[model samples]
Target chain A: LAKTTQPISMDSYEGQEVNITCSHNNIATNDYITWYQQFPSQGPRFIIQGYKTKVTNEVASLFIPADRKSSTLSLPRVSLSDTAVYYCLVGVPSNDYKLSFGAGTTVTVRA
Target chain B: SAVISQKPSRDICQRGTSLTIQCQVDSQVTMMFWYRQQPGQSLTLIATANQGSEATYESGFVIDKFPISRPNLTFSTLTVSNMSPEDSSIYLCSVEDGARGTQYFGPGTRLLVL
Candidate 1:
């Protein structure tokens, strides 16, 4: 499993964009960059995933450089409801591949 | 995305007792996992529930403490035995969405050991 490093916390106001970067220096060639958003008392929700370059979805966008050492999750026009812990995970999507989560970046969206 | 659900959404159990959490998925999945999340802490992988074989546990977790059962592809159960206050946390189960290359998790079973 590739170890990921991300910020512990980030603060953002409504209507502003929030970007969270994650570093996975040991990422493998088969690994994919995935981000999950977890709200209080709920399971983590899949936000975006990408193997390289950029991938955009309705909720967020993922940008992975060519090196794949790091990636960023960009949330455009955030709102208070977006306040939650975001986890970045890098691994293959195999059946035996275990998903390990680190201390996620807690994004607090304020008014 | 698979719809996952867990039984006993929240429970208060006495120390030394055991509680079994059930996880159900809307569709058949090849891989099912159990995880523990301590209060204000990150998620920890407990084990991988294999359909026909014994579950594979992580380094810090054991079958004696966290017994797992995957009778079929869409359902599994986890039993927390001889619980302690330190075991008070949220237990969750997830199913792998191989097509999407991600996992969908259940609402999680909140356990409070007293």
Candidate 2:
């Protein structure tokens, strides 16, 4: 498992774009970057995942550079409801059965 | 994504007592996971529940403290034994989406030990 470091907290305003970055300096070739969003009192939800370059979905986008040492999660036009803890995880496909979550970055979306 | 659910969504237990949390997935899964989230803390993997075998627990967690059972593919249970104030947290169950390697979580069981 690759240890990840991310901002402890971030504040963003409604309608503004929010980007959160995670660094996994020792990331392995087989590891993939996956991001999850967790609301208070609920389990974390899958947001987006990527191995390299950029991947976008209905909810968010993930950008991974060639180095794969870091990745960014971009949320478009954020809303107050988007406030939650976002976790960045790096692991291999075979280890999909196990996941380690860090403290995560707590995004506070204010009006 | 998998639709997961848990039993006894919330509970208040006395010290030294035990509580059992059940997790059910809409479809069969080869692997299931149990996680704990303490107040103001991130989710921590407690163990991996595999069907027909003893669950593999993570460091700092043990079978006696957090007993797990995966009798079938879609259902599993985690019993929090000898509860204490520190054990008060949200317990979540998850299953992997084999195709994408993503995990879907249940609503979670909130346990408050008094």
Give the residue spans of candidate 1 off by over 4 A: none
lDDT of 1 by residue, A1-103 (tens): 9999999999999999999999999999999889999999999888888999999999999999999999999999999999999999999876375788999
Q: lDDT per residue, candidate 2, A1-111, as tens digits?
A: 999999999999999999999999999989999999999878999898899999999999999999999999999999999999999999986574588898899999999
Task: Give residue B66's error in model 2 in angstroms.
Answer: 1.2
What is the per-residue lDDT of model 2 for residues B36-84, given as tens digits with 9 covering 90 to 100?
9988998899999989989999999999999999999999999999999
Give per-model TM-scores: 0.97, 0.98
TM-score of chain B of each: 0.98, 0.98
CA-lDDT, candidates in order: 0.94, 0.94
Please write out the lDDT profile of model 1 over residues B1-114, one tens digit for every residue: 789999999999999999999999999987899999999999999998879999999999999999999999999999999999999999999988787668899999999999
